[model samples]
Target: MEILSKNLQLLHFLDKEDMAGFWKLKMMILKITSHSWRNWISI
Candidate 1:
């Protein structure tokens, strides 16, 4: 959880630095994690 939060902070910082790539990467990560969470909950 700490690592995740740190990574999220890094992503946010990168988003501020380079909006386009950051937005794309952020969305992709969000989609992947959201799907994983859903699957985990279902199990």
Candidate 2:
């Protein structure tokens, strides 16, 4: 039971980190797309 609880805690922590990474990736993509849009507008 103790081992199972520890495993659950670790999985929860990893899930949080994965969500953070996912958001970061999304922000990066947004930034890139917006930057390209600005360049296209300038052209």
Candidate 3:
């Protein structure tokens, strides 16, 4: 039971870390997409 609880805690921590990384990646993609669109329109 103790081992299981520890594993759950680790999983939760990893989930939060992944969520943060996912958000950062999403923002980067959005920024790149918007920049490309602006360039396309300017051209």
TM-score of each: 0.57, 0.67, 0.66
Model 2, stretches more than 4 Å misplaced?
1-14
Per-model clash counts, in order, read 0, 0, 0
Comparing 1 and 3 on lDDT, the stronger one: 3
Q: Can you write out model 3's per-residue Cα lDDT over 13-37, one digit (the tens) per residue?
A: 7877798897999999999999999
TM-score of 3: 0.66
lDDT of 1 by residue, 1-43 (tens): 9999998888777645588876889999999999999999999
| Candidate 2 lDDT tens digits, 1-43 | 9999998887677877797897999999999999999999999
Off by over 4 Å in 1: 1-17
Cα lDDT, model 1, residue 29: 100
Worst 10 residues of 3 by lDDT: 8-17
Q: What TM-score does prediction 1 earn?
A: 0.57
Per-residue lDDT, model 3, residue 27, is 100
